[model samples]
Target: MPRFISKSLKKVGSSPGTLIHVGEIKTEQSSLSMLHFDAETHIEQPLTDIGEATSLLTPDATTWINVVGIQDIALIEDIGRHYHIHPLTLEDILNTTQRPKVESFDDYLFIVIKMLEHDKEKDSIVSEQLSLVLGKTVLISFQEDEGDVFNPVRERIRKGKGRIRSAGCDYLAYALIDAIVDNYFVILENVGQRLEAVEEAIDSDLDADILEKIHTIRRELIYLRKQVWPIREIITYLQKDGAPLIGEATGPFLRDVYDHTIQVIDTIESLRDMLSGMQDLYLSIISNRMNEVMKVLTIIATIFIPLSFIAGIYGMNFNHMPELTWRWGYPAVWLLIIGIVAMMIVFFRRKKWI
Candidate 1:
């Protein structure tokens, strides 16, 4: 079963605003990490409780609180209560099957997007839902598990690279989203490589599993398209909705991310078209191979028809079969058989059918 469909089935009868964890339990326990930074100073620490998040927020410094696991409903509730997040937003955060979207609230903006990574060992794409809440001086990021593609963003924050250190929480939110969108390129690059391999296999060597490979890539593209297509609208909303949490300085950067999203979507569509073409090409190759085999079998059958007829006539124990009783009949029949076969071979060669 596809992960998207299977995870959504668990929420069939759920009421509105119900806090229920809907996806895979990626971590044993949810963990919190805070990065509070300004233009010159930075403080990074792990909190033992959600209550600590309030104390870490400062007027001068932008705080980024990262929750590594979302399976703990109580923890999510605590964070929601502390942050004044809406129950519907909290429900969306808990329900990992939520689509990529953005909701604007009075104090904060709720953004949900899928963070995708290529799992090399499994040779497949792994998706985790990421929910971001952007407030005045703080931004809280919720993830499904520990590992993420935000290490580069973290390193930038740690080293105080670019304008991120001097910027507001909106800029930080943009940075994190830009990181996710950038990682899409990396994942798409991996998918592109897989598509190339499949194409090469289809052209050079038609393995039995080539169709399965094409299908696997098609499914991955479908999954990726599902996750990525809505992000254009999400980014567009963030740019145009005039959410107070999103600053004017972040507009250009958001536009940049929007362009990148468009690029990613285009790449996905191109890969999908390539997969469809590859599928048709695979079918054509298989059909041509079958036709070749059938043609050879038909030719062989055609060649043997006369020989079988002669042998059938000779095998009949008719009282006076002239050819069967003649002394030279056996060798003559053998010569005739060979001559007919040679003539058929020459004819086939002249017709370019062999």
Candidate 2:
């Protein structure tokens, strides 16, 4: 589960206070990769030391320093020192569970987004926190792990395709956000398919396994919706809050990302509604099975009512009963009881109540 840290934790590098590890502690070390690029040329390098990354952050060309892991607090602090990032911002970066948000400062703009990817074999969704820092001619990103959904953007930058290379750092930020949002669609598709499979199985007999699968899908969707809803507000704030770091040219792109977020929210809401309906349907099916069981038991008791009455009458020892004295009377009474039971069975069959 992802913990939403309080804004008070935003205090920059303040005493390493109470490091609340929200999710998992990855085994990988925090590594830095620098991609310094311009319209005509590009350069990418892996940094062994944080100081080596600072010399590459020049105003002459746009730089994208991608941080792969974030467990090393010292490295993060050093990078913060180099860029003059606020302590609170550093805290947010170290805490990968932070919500999607955008903040503008005198020197740079900070944006946090959650990246979603679905693992088919595991049948689970993986979430990664991607934090982007935009300067005049550079963009820095920190990821919880290596290999993100930004490979497409990297390809675009490498191949010099489209306007990505021609644009500034803000445009790169838009591209990164857009890529993350697009991957949400992929995840939603998988979830929708799983829901559909569960629904089809539900149509026959309400299998316990099927219902459990449905429940699992519902839980995942709930988690996804929780993660995405606030992102809508984050994008809206970026578009309307008039952040200085977001360029006028990049505003429309960010607005486009806002639209994508809205689409994601709409899809999530639909999934939730579907899951609710599935729950109700499962309940009805289980109830119907229970009613059928009760009906069968009641019909068996009904069929035995007259038979029991016949047995009770013969069971009485009455001196005035002349039939009890007759030799064939006992056999005749047994035949009569059998005949009555046979008649009841036929009647139940005719009524379709058995």
Candidate 3:
């Protein structure tokens, strides 16, 4: 399926802020996981109800609610009502087509970003919508599917390898966003490797499959561009506009992430140029090969032109023709045709057109 087809198709006539799930709908209920932790204590639980999850959000704890599936309309609505999130924000969360953006609300800061990863099995880029609501002491995340690119951040939080253990909810938000951005680097690396393989294949010859691969990579780059470009704006807003939900100490890290995004954008642009050049290179290769074939055929026809005329002249039966009566006439005509073909071959070889 096309990656972005997760955008709800059933909302053609539905009103705005209607609690209708737009993406894939599953029969199985959505899974909710909770991580409540502070500097001195940590608690992880699997909650079957949003109410259970809400009760655990004490004032001293920093909680991360990861809703594995966003297809449950009632579930999302209940949670939104409990947390005092805006209806429009819930609408965006359900829509799943929301671009990478940051919007300030009365209670929390809402962030919607595309989580991109290279699908090695499919050899394509796959994207999932990740919605984050950053409040004073809690960060709620929503995703379309159960799998995500947040495992590294979860691992870091569990290991306490960094200042994440000591920071507030803002830092946790930063950590999550940072993890997503870091995966961009990995995605780009995979794309770079694919581009390299396509380029190397072009050196030997051109084929329909190679051309298709070029177009596929071009499409991937375009998709990556669409996802990457808007994220720069999101990061810029978070860094320059200084959303209150973000910490003062986290500003530097946000700036660093902004720089990383800038670098990623720069790399994406570079790869785009390279992919464009590869397209031109593919065309040039095909054109040169075509010209080579035409050159060879033209040479063969040029060599045959005089030989055809000579044969045609002697082929007509006429009593007035003198060569027809000679004993060596057939052998002479054969030698003359062979000699002309040899001379043409030599001339073509010397001209470097063979």
Candidate 4:
């Protein structure tokens, strides 16, 4: 079985809110970029230093600071210094295995969620932890790697194609969250396709290998559920908790996200049930094939029984066998045996047992 929670042994002896990297090392170095925009003006800048990024982050306009990698402990500490981000929230951000959740701080909202995609090369699900910090006029995002499921959102914000430009930081946060949620649908669709392929394979080839595939799909669904199930509560808190960090305009959008989360939960459950049924069906196919073999063997054995009996009597060394001494006895016995076999075959055919 694959490990569900990534090993975080680096955090074994650390303090409760220590900023130790706890996931895979995906990149060589971290990169920071900022997109500051509002109704009429927009600024795009690549940041090399946290101080510069902090200086640019003001309430004058909506800003989005995207940190591509979080393995550098120093960088996380620097951001914490400027934002007054709680140590615990930073801890969760570094721990990629943390479950999806939302929390409100003094001046910001901390959101942790999973970004998942199916890797065709690995034939498995790949997951990453995405942490979002929503403030009054700024939204900071932390990712494990550069480029993400947010490219479409970036395109929208750049073209001013939607309300994202005229919206506050909260709406920008909503757009990001919506993009992530929409990705779930894509991943689930891929899973559904794989299920269909496996289901077809089960019908044509019932073997141990198919059993292994079933187990694999089951594991994938289990992990997906772990990531998605918590999202319901995460969004529920935003929609109902009345968090000041989440704008009133964003409430309806978060509610829509919550509804989508429920749909994802339902899809995961239905797929799980389908996989269970598939396992049972595999067992049934194997059992039925075994029964077929046994039935054929029994029929062949039954047909030879009378022939063996006749041969045994004739081969006995006693002279009291009348049929053995008769001139036509040999041919007569042959005829009788052949007649018996013919009759038995007809009987079996009529009974549909042949």
For 240-340, candidate 4 gives per-residue lDDT tens digits of: 78467777888888888888988988999999999899889888888888999998998888989999998888888697878767899999999999998
What TM-score would candidate 1 get against the native? 0.95
TM-score of each: 0.95, 0.89, 0.93, 0.92
Cα error, candidate 3, residue 321 (Å): 0.9
- Give lDDT tens digits, candidate 1, residues 200-312: 99889999998899888888899999999998888889888946777788899999999999999999999999889989999999999999999999999999999999888
Q: Write the per-residue lDDT of candidate 2 for residues 79-181, one digit (tens) a residue.
A: 8888888877887787776777888888888888888888777898877888888888878898888778888988888888988887888788889888888
State how far residue 95 of model 4 sits from its true place (Å). 1.0
Q: Candidate 3's residue-wise lDDT over 311-350, tens digit each? A: 8898788899878988998899899999999998998889
RMSD each, Å:
1.7, 3.3, 2.1, 2.1
In order, candidate lDDTs are 0.90, 0.80, 0.84, 0.86
Error of 3 at 103 (Å): 0.8
Please list the residue runs of candidate 1 whose C-alpha ends up more than 4 Å from where it truly belongs after superposition: 6-14
Candidate 3 — worst ten consecutive residues by lDDT sum? 1-10
Highest lDDT scorer: 1
Which runs of model 3 end up more than 4 angstroms from their true locations?
1-9, 205-207, 349-351
Ranked by TM-score from best down, the candidates are: 1, 3, 4, 2
